[model samples]
Target: MNRLTAVTLGVADLEASAGFYSGIFDTPPNRDHDGVCFFPLPGCWISLFPLGHLAEDISPEVPKTRSGFSGVTLAHNVKTKDEVIAVLERARAAGAAIVKEAQDTFWGGFSGYFADPDGYHWEVVWGPMFDFTDDGALLFGKG
Candidate 1:
């Protein structure tokens, strides 16, 4: 049996994408070589590679051009509602498109959405009843 170990994103500029995620996640790349950068997250690896190269690696086919929303969103869960706003603010300053401003949600949490240069969506959220370990793993229902 195999486990999903990493999530790699194809970006136009590897260094810029690396910097963007590094700032938000507060973790520097563990390895950067030959136009690829790897950041080790709690239980997975986040990699940034050139779009053309990533396409070639996955298949001889060129990468697909995305339209509208892809229905995929990366999330950042913070300790406080204020942190959600702060994160969104930071992302905006870093050139992310603010798709949705932070606000109280019907789900009893607070969140907002933003998009990277390539239009990949991200949700920055804070839930009063959710907690995370130091290693970035979530522990829910026990605030």
Candidate 2:
């Protein structure tokens, strides 16, 4: 019960948004229904639904325009800086907005950022100072 089941994004057009995600993930939606598209992630799913419906489901007060920094980001951890570059390139090729090019950071890592069709920020990163288990779970300061 403690595990997250899904992370859903509010989108303007389900088809276009789903298409954009398909290209980014290099896979089609695991499930597509009348009003939503669902992509399976490692331990959860990413869902896309119409913005209006999402607003209604959550609360009518939810802001319609999600622009600028929404103070939220999604991240994918990689084992190397080359992997980071590869992911960013794929995202760009899939029509993502490359917000930041891969580069060494003061935190002793290499990373880049991209914005998906809905302007959700994602970071591809390689942190030599962090440890990752066989299943890719991250543990800090254990490099």
- Candidate 2 lDDT over 76-99, as tens digits, reads 788888989999998998889999
TM-score of each: 0.85, 0.85
| lDDT tens readout by residue for model 1, 30-109 | 65377888988766777888878888887887754445677778877888999999999889887888999999999899
- Model 2, which residues run further than 4 Å from truth? 133-143
lDDT of 2 at 76: 78
- Misplaced by over 4 Å in model 1 are 1-4, 62-65
**lDDT top scorer:** 2
Pairs in clash, predicted candidate 1: none
Give Cα distance to truth, residue 46, candidate 2, Å: 1.6
